[model samples]
Target: MIRDVAVLALEGSHAFELGVFCEVFGIDRSDDALPGYDFALVSATGDSVSTRHGFDVRTPHGLERLSSADLICVPAYDLRVRQPDRLAHELRAAAERGARVLSICTGAFLLGEAGLLDGRRCTTHWRYTDELARRHPRARVESDVLYVDQDPIITGAGTAAGVDTCLHVVRREHGSAVANTIARRMVAAPHREGGQRQYRERPQPREGTGSLAPVLGWIEANLDQNLTVEAMARHAHLSPRTFARRFQQEAGTTPLQWLTGQRVLLAQHHLETTDDPITAIARCTGLGTVDNLRHHFVRRLGITPQGYRRAFRAPHNK
Candidate 1:
C-alpha cells in the first residue's frame, strides 16, 4: 500500500544521508525479484539544492508533491538556517493527514523546528542528542537506538543509520522479505541491534599517526578467530589494559563488545543471504552454537535467528 514516497531535501542537506533515501526507496528492484517503490526527491522550491557534501541535487517537484505521498522523508540539514513558516506548516499538514513522516540523522532537527517532535519519543545522531534536547525541551530524545518509529513519525541516528531506518520503513510497509532482498542487492546488512549505545565509546587517537585503521580492518577480517583483548593488544604491541583502553578509543567500543556486534552483523548477513543452516552460520560467525546465536540475536534484534530468517528469506528458499 506504500506506493509513493517523497524525500524532502531541505537547504544544506547531507548528500550521503539523502542518497540513503534514494537508494532504498528510489532504486527500482523489480528486475531483481523485489517490489519497487515510487520515490521522488522534492524541495521547497522545485529547484537545485546544495548539500553539505558540496554537490547539488535537482528536484522537479515542489512541496505540492508531498500532499499525495504515502511517506515523507526529511534528510539531515543545517539547523542554523531560518526555518520558513510555510515549510513547517506543510510538514505538519502532511503528518496530520496520515502520511508517515520520517527524518534521517539531524533531519529530526527540522521536525523539532516544525514542532512535530513535541511530546513525541524520537532520536537523532548521538552527536546531536544534547542539542536536540536543548532546543526542544518537550521532545523526548532517545540517544541509544539506531532509530525510533513512533507510529507515523520516525527518526534515525546518524549517517549509515539512515539506511537502517529506510529499510525499516520498507519492512513495515511491504514486509521483511522485500526489505531484506533490497538490502542484499545493496550489499548492506538488513538489521543492527542494541542501538547507538554500542557506538558511543570514544575511540583512541591514532598511535603517533600510525593509524588504527589497519588494525581495525584486520579485526574485521579475522572476526571468526578468538579475538581476546590480550591477543589484540599483543598485535598492537601494547599492554592489555592500554590496548583495551585504546581499542575503546579507536573503535568506539570495548574490543569484546565491538567483536560481538560485528559477529552479530555477520550472522544477520548470513541469515538474509545464504541458505546455510543456523548451526553452520553460527559456527562460521564464531557465535559458538545455534542456541547461543539465538539468544544473542533475540536479545539484540528482538527476534530469534530462525524467525528473522523466516521473515526475510525468499518464499522458495523458505
Candidate 2:
C-alpha cells in the first residue's frame, strides 16, 4: 500500500544514510519484477544541498512533497547542530495525516525534536541513547535493538541498522516474498532480526568513575535465577537502599526492573529463534508461568508472546 515515499534531506546530512534511502527506494526496480516505489529526495528550501561527505545534490521538490508521501524517512543528522523548525513542523504534519515516519541513527533525534517521539518507543545510535532519553523523557528508549518499529513511527540504531529497518518496511508493506526478491537483487540479507542487539565493541558502565560492570555481567549470565533488588544489592556489595538509588542513577532503572527486562529480552530471543513452547520459554526466563510471561510480555511489548513468535519466526519454521 505504500507506493510513494519522500526522504527529507537537510544541510549537513550524512550522505551514506541518505544513499541508503535512495538505494532501497529511489531506484526503479520494475525491471527486476519488483513493485516500484515512487521516491523523491526533497529539501526544505528546494535548492541544492551539500552533504556531510562534501557532495552536492539538487532537489526541486520542497516540503510540499512530504504531504503526499505514504511514508517519510528522515535519515541521520548531526544532532549537535540545529535543525530548522519549519522542516520539523512539516514532518510532524505529514505524520499527523497518517504518513509513516521513520528515522535512521541520529535521525531519531530530529523526530524527538519534532515532538513525534513522545511517549513512544524509539532507539537511536547507542552512543546517543542517553542524550535522547534525557531530551525526551516521554520516549521509552531501547538501546539494544537494531531498530524499534512502533508502527506509524519507526527508528533504527546506528548506521548499518538502517538497511534492516528499510527491509522491514518492505516486508510489512509487500510481504516477505517481494522483500526477499529485492534483497536478492541488492545482494543483502532478506531479513535481519530487528530485535538483535546493536553491536558495541566494548560497552562500559554508565560512568567511568566506578563500574556497575560486574553486577550487569552477573545479571546477564544468571538470567534464569530469581534476581531481586535485595539479592542484587548484596551481590554489588551495597545495602538495598544504596544499591536501589545507585542502580537508578547508573542504569536508569531499578535493579528488579532491569532484571525483569533482561528476562523478557531472553524470552523474546527464544520465541523468535527457537522451537520452544511458551511454557518452556517462561520457565527458562524465570518468569515462572506462561500466564505471568504473557502478562509481562504484553505490558512491555504490546504483543503477546505467541503473537510475536508468529510474526517473527523463521519462514521454514512457520
Candidate 3:
C-alpha cells in the first residue's frame, strides 16, 4: 500500500545512504514487473542540499511534498551539524498522521531529535549505538541488530543495512515476491534476518573454519529435508559444537535459527505466489504440518498463513 514516497534530503546527508533510498524507491523499475513508487527528494526550503561528499542534490520539492507521502525517509547526515528545526517538527507530525518514517545510520539522530525514538525499540550503526542511546535516554536502542522495525518507525544500522531496511518495507507491504524481484534487480540479498546480530570488526573468519556460502546454498536447496545440527555439521566437515560456534561467527546466528528463518521466508513466498494448500506448502518448506507452519507464520509475522495469502496473494493468482 506504500505508494507515495518522499526522502528528506537534509543538508550534509551522506550520499550513499541517500542513494540507498534512490536506488530502492526512486528508480522506474516497472519494466522489470516491479511496482513503481512516487519517489521524490525533498529539502527544507526547496533548495539544493549539499552532501557531506561535496556533491549537491536538488529536486523541485520541499517539506510540502511530505504532507501526502505514505513513507518518509531520513538518510545519514553529519550529526555534529544542526538541522533545520522544522524538519524535526514536521517529521514528528507526519508519523502522528500515520506516515511511516525510516532512518538510516546517523539518520536515527534526527528521529531521536524529533522524539520519535522515545518509547520505541530502534537501532543504528554499531559504532553509533552507544551515542544514540546516550542522546535519547527514553529510546530502547538495540546495539547489534541489522535494523529494528517498530511499525511506523524503522531504523537501519549502517550503510548497507539501509537496503535491508527498505526491502523489508517492500516485502511487508507488497509481498515477498515483489520484494525479491526488486532485490534481484539490485543484485542484493532478498532478505537478511533483521535479528541477526552485528558481527565484531574482524578482518577474516577464524583460521580453520572455511567459507559458509556452499553450506548455506545447500541448506536452501534442501529445506524440505530433515536438517539437524549433526547433519549440517557433517556436511561442513566439522563437529556439531564447532559448527555451531563457527556459524555464529560467520552468519551472526545459530544454524537452526537461520534455518527456521529461511523456512519461514520460503513459506511466505509460497503463500504469496502459489495456490497450494497450506499443508502442501508446509511440507515443501519443511515446516512439517499445517499447525507448525501456522505457528511460525503467526509468531514471526503476526498473521496466519491463510490470512497472509488472502491479504498478499499475487493478482494473477487471485
Candidate 4:
C-alpha cells in the first residue's frame, strides 16, 4: 500500500539516517521479487543541502513532491538548527491529508514544530528525549522504546531504530514477505518490537562481558521446550530474583520476554518457509496450542498466525 515515498533532506541532516531511508525505500529490489517504491529525496530548504559530515547532497525534488507521497520520512538533522516555516506548513498539510509521516531521531522536532506532536505519543533519540519532552510538554514522549507507531505518525528513537520503524510500516502496509525481503537485502533484522528498549550509552553486554550468552543460545536452540525464568535461572547458576535482575541489566529485557520474542521469531520463520499446520507450528514453538499461538501472534504482530502465513509463505507453498 505504501509505494510512493519521499524523504525530506534538510540542512545538516545525518547521512546515516538519510541512507537508512534510501536503503529501505529507494533501492530497486524488484529483481528479488520485492516491491520497488517510487522514491524521491526532497529538499526541504533548497535544492542543495549540506550534511552534518560537511558534504553536500543536491536533490531535484522539493516540498511539492510530498503532495503525492504515501509516506513521508524525515531524517535526523542538527537539533540546534531551525526548520523553515514553509516546510513545517507542508508537512502539517500532508499529515492532514492522511499521509503517514515518520521521523527518525531528532527529526521529531520538525513534527513538533508543525504542531503534529501535540497530544500525541511520540519519541526521538534517547539522548534528546528529555529535551523533546521539555519543549513539547503536551506530547507524550517515551524515551526508552525503539519506536512508537501512533498511526499516521511514527517516531523512531535514534539512528539504527529508523530501519526497524520503516520496515514495520512496510510490513503493516505490504505484508511481512515484502518487508523481510527488503530487510534481507539490507542485512538487517526483519523485526524488532517497538516496545524493546533502545540500549543507549553502554555497549550491549555480550558473551565475553559476563552476559547470559550461552543461556540465550540454549534458549534459542530449544524454543520448543517450555522455557521458564526459574529454569533459566538454574541454568545460569543463580537464584531466580538475582538472575532476573542480572538478565535485565545485561540483556535489556526480562528472561521470559526474551524467550517469548525468540519463540515468536521461530514461529514466523516456520510460517514463511514451511507449510506446517498452525497446531504443529504452535507445538514446535512451545506455544502449547493453536489458540495460544494465535493469541500471542496477534498480540505481538498485529496479525493472526494463519494470516501471517498466507501473507509470507513461499510462493510455491501458496
The per-candidate count of clashes, in order, stands at: 5, 0, 0, 0
> Tens-digit lDDT track for model 2 on 1-318?
788999999788898788888988988988876778888989988887878778888978888889899999998976656777898798789889899999999999889988899999999989999999999999999988888988799999888889889988886665556677778877876665566667743342553456677888888898888888888889989999988877766664557777877787788778767899899999989899999999988886677989877876667655
Clashes, model 1:
5
Clashing pairs in 2: none
Expressed as tens digits, the lDDT of each residue in 1-318 for candidate 4 is 678999999998999999999998999888887778899999965488999999999888978899999999999999777768888899999999999999999999999988899999998989999999988899999988999988889999899999999998887766667787788888987877788889834455677746778888888888898788999889888899999988887767788888888888888888988888889999999988999899889988878998888776767666
Q: Sorted on TM-score, highest at the top, how do the candidates line up?
A: 3, 4, 1, 2
lDDT (C-alpha, whole model) for all candidates: 0.81, 0.83, 0.90, 0.87
TM-score of 3: 0.95
Q: In candidate 4, what residue range of length 10 has the lowest lDDT sum? A: 200-209
Show model 3 residue runs off by greater than 4 Å: 200-209
Please rank every candidate by lDDT, starting with the best: 3, 4, 2, 1
Q: What is the lDDT of candidate 4?
A: 0.87
Q: Candidate 1 or 4, higher TM-score?
A: 4
Error of 2 at 265 (Å): 20
The lDDT of model 2 is 0.83
Error of 1 at 222 (Å): 5.4
Candidate 2, superposed: residue stretches over 4 Å from native: 200-318
Evaluated with lDDT, which candidate comes out highest? 3
Per-candidate TM-scores read 0.69, 0.65, 0.95, 0.90
lDDT value, residue 94 of candidate 3 = 97
Give the poorly placed runs of model 4, Cα more than 4 Å off.
Answer: 174-181, 200-202
